[model samples]
Target: MPVADDIKSSWADEVELEGGALPPSTEVRENGFKIVTDYKYNEDEKKLKIVRTYKIEKRTVSKSIALRKTWKKFGESATDKPGPNPATTIASEDVYMQYVTSKEEDNKPEDESSIDKLKSLGDKSVVRCRTCGQEHWTTKCPWKDTVLIGGKLPDDKKGPAVTTGFTNAETGKPGGSKYVPPNMRDGAAKRTDSTNMARRDDTTAIRVSNLSESTTENDLEDLVKPFGPIQKLYLAKDKTTGACKGFAYIHFKFRNDAAKAIQALNGHGYDHLILNVDWSKPPTHSNQ
Candidate 1:
């Protein structure tokens, strides 16, 4: 059976598809190998998981190309004759953080003040948990599962109501039907080219925040320029307040710089809320 390489697919959409209809169960028992045939469907994916993994040892055991190669790679790395295990060391992690403010230790100007340095390298810092009343970071918070505001659950929180379908002004063909929650309207991206070409620096976007309440579009632009060559800075605000909505966007001249900012701020929050850093602008052709 031809299996799909849909490992990175979403929870609901990662269905395995077989190319064609399969022949009825046939036992192709060779000299020393036993062959088993079955068709099983993975309920969650609503797809098939035709084959499973197992090991068999015989007087003269032989494995398929894929398994042999995988075994060779695993065995080579697991050997203690030399180097460290690359697979064991490389893993991605998610983290939560908080930044606190304090009065400057030096007589430097407040605006140009630097963060106060810790007294010693191994100094014990006591942190209060956000969810629980524990004396440790949020990761170790015992009451992480407890209710915070005693209101609606975060998962139960609902926002603006949405229409299931809308009249299609363009084709009169149900101009907009909501098959998915985010529906493509979340972005102005082209599907055909998105799977192929990438967006250029001029089209990249940045998530800018912590901007002063009096910061105007012009001031936001000037602040972001020093980070790197800036393509654009988009500042959205409440129409009545005239105050910054605690968020702004900046497009960088290069994608790397934008990625750097995202890495620096995402999860590592400032003020409190973890910034939502993402590519807001869609990809274009000329800039690439």
Candidate 2:
């Protein structure tokens, strides 16, 4: 038989050649290695451009997390394949919020019961002014400068009504809606002028002079406390240094006790100074 030149070749007749094909654009390497796939150079800009892709190696994860990943998805995600669905899972945008008072609600009429409840709650928390017994701080009381006798206001200065939100135990009626002074409260006793004047009397008070600068109120109290129950004791001291100003006033509950203290303590040696004890004289005002 003669050789046919136009016959097609089969795969069995083809022979393998060494180093025949060129390598791919991306170099093959182990996982976690960075591979450069494309690069370009710009001559006018004097810059080189290169693109790279990294294959991160598989990391060991906790058993709980790995198990959770294997849990079958449900709800809208039941038909979703493994991995997050771009349609259902998207990046969250930042949200901003602000506080704004509603003007429409300000004009709304409040229920009477709600108003009473609020007033009751406020009575528990609101400060009771000592000066006027009003629902305000003592410093903000309108009658702060007014004189009070036994912590009660005078009859003429009393307010029209009481708004303490307290119900009368016997009558079972709501207290009126006006501020009431503490003195005018139910069961409050009346104070007379004679009692107030008796408390202010200085007849039983004695003065001690020539005291040491280091004498304290306690030291002076100890010196004359044996005489009688001391009503009030005041030790005059320097405002800047806090040292005794060499004089003190001690008031006794009885004039006889004060007289005994004066007779015994006068010219007595104490704290390296002679104690000059005498009855405290009332201040004399020059006729203006």
Candidate 3:
């Protein structure tokens, strides 16, 4: 059967209240009146469609529930971080450069301030701001860049000296680098700094505490030399008397080579005992 067109979101579900109105009041109650009940029916198809109809209404929630939801999704923004650490490499632009002119001539110009010599120069040299060093060219260096292990640290190196000795740049004292007189060489044929870059193959000097009374420097070198070059192999002796102190310093030409010796022969047979091997470096405060 055809019916009234629509329904709604929330139905009032109306019913006459059981106790509220005190029964049609005393004065009107004495009279009886005709009551009309509206009945709706199906004409042809025989089914009841609009049994009854009611309207719906809605209301807002109290304050407490709205506040509870505010806290769940946003406490603070996470898109931030602290600045870079001091130990980090810094990037920037401060550079200097120099060059040589007229190399075929016996005396190359000592200075590079003149542009007249720029075309005449045999080669160009770049002074890197990052490392504070000079190179024959700027091919590899970036103009402004984050510092790198590109050059030596000041503490790791010292001003070039006019002399040389065993006090070479490690442990007990100062370091040294090969240098040539400004008067002699055609170009700087960079001298290697034995102390600055401690290559993995650099020597690991060992001072064993309990070496056998019979173990000699030659004996230790004889064992390790097979694996790598044994540089300055010797056992430490008493300062005045000259008897073996039962300990030795076996310097390898390289650090990794020394490590290999410490690994392969550390627990090997040494006459009556095994060698006690350890790496010795000048002790720092924290290492203490």
Candidate 4:
């Protein structure tokens, strides 16, 4: 009995010296604690406590990537829900703004010149430079330190009409302009000089070919009236007989109308003859 009592006393002393025992690589601190190994245990009547601490590092995210993530989350939520959600709405707005900014960046010219910017404007777009109040590059601005000298080419001026007070010997008509020298004119121009000078072509006009000689201007008008308003109708006729020459030009008030008339009337049969309709070629000279 005495030996057993001595052994128990020695064991208690050993436990006190070792701080009531601890897990491997763990130490007993004088303060609250270092780490919590288990959820069990407590002091007094409370549940057992395990204290722990960690040195957590903060993470940084890029704006683009963060926006993308938020947008993705919002999309998922919207897909699951039937109606609108504030979170999804905000996300969509941000995403759309980012997309537009990206597109602007892509479309931006490398030089960023006002001239380049003005040239890039589409039919629907109009850009006015803030510096010059003109639709051109800012760097080329007159108000800037650098002056743009003659950025535009000189105007093409027709050297004053060569007025030669002469008359055609056979025609007995006063010719204010000298005839283009035979050697100087291109061969094509020389061959069709008279016809080219006498005839004119309108842009908003459709030429009808393969027409019956009996086809009159009135008849052509009736055929094209359904498409648009008629500006003028000229049915070629024989100067002597005053009979149609089997071809005519029909001008429309609008180019769109002319195009529509061509589409509807081309290859259409009129007066028992199939008509060929197409855009009239513009004349070379203003006189024509």
Query: Highest lDDT, which number?
Result: 2
- Candidate 3 RMSD to the correct structure: 30.2
Question: Over the stretch 1-288, how does candidate 2's per-residue lDDT look in tens digits?
Answer: 235555545455553222123234554355666556543336663334354545656668999998987899999889985545557777699887877889767654554445456567866555567655666667755545333323354545333332233333224222432444445443232333333454466889999999999999999999999999999999999999999999999999999999999999999999999999999986765221
Order of candidate numbers by lDDT, starting with the best: 2, 4, 1, 3
What overall lDDT, based on C-alpha atoms, would model 1 receive against the true structure?
0.49
Candidate that scores best on TM-score: 2
Model 1, span 1-288: residue lDDT tens: 235564555555433334234435444456655454545445563435343222344444456754664443456455631222334655468776877556564445532322223223344454445543444566654434322222212322222221112223123232233343332221212332354333444346776665446667876665556557777677978799987777787877787777776766556544345555655655345433
So what's the TM-score on candidate 1?
Answer: 0.25
Clashing pairs in 4: 41-48, 41-49, 42-47, 42-48, 114-136, 114-137, 115-137
lDDT of each: 0.49, 0.67, 0.47, 0.58
**What is model 4's C-alpha RMSD?**
30.7
How well does candidate 3 match the true structure in TM-score terms? 0.29
Tens-digit per-residue lDDT, 1-288, candidate 4: 888876756867876656544444333343543333334424553344454443333457899876765554354564643223435454333433333357667656654665465576663235554343566555545433321122221223111221122223224232333455542222223345445433433778888899998877777778789998898888999999988998888888888999998898888887787889999877556543
Candidate 2 or 3, higher lDDT? 2
Q: Any idea what lDDT model 4 has?
A: 0.58
Which of the two, 2 or 3, has more TM-score?
2
Worst 10 residues of 1 by lDDT: 155-164
Ranking by TM-score: 2, 4, 3, 1
Clashes of 3: 8
Point out where model 1 deviates above 4 Å: 1-203, 209-223, 268-273, 281-288
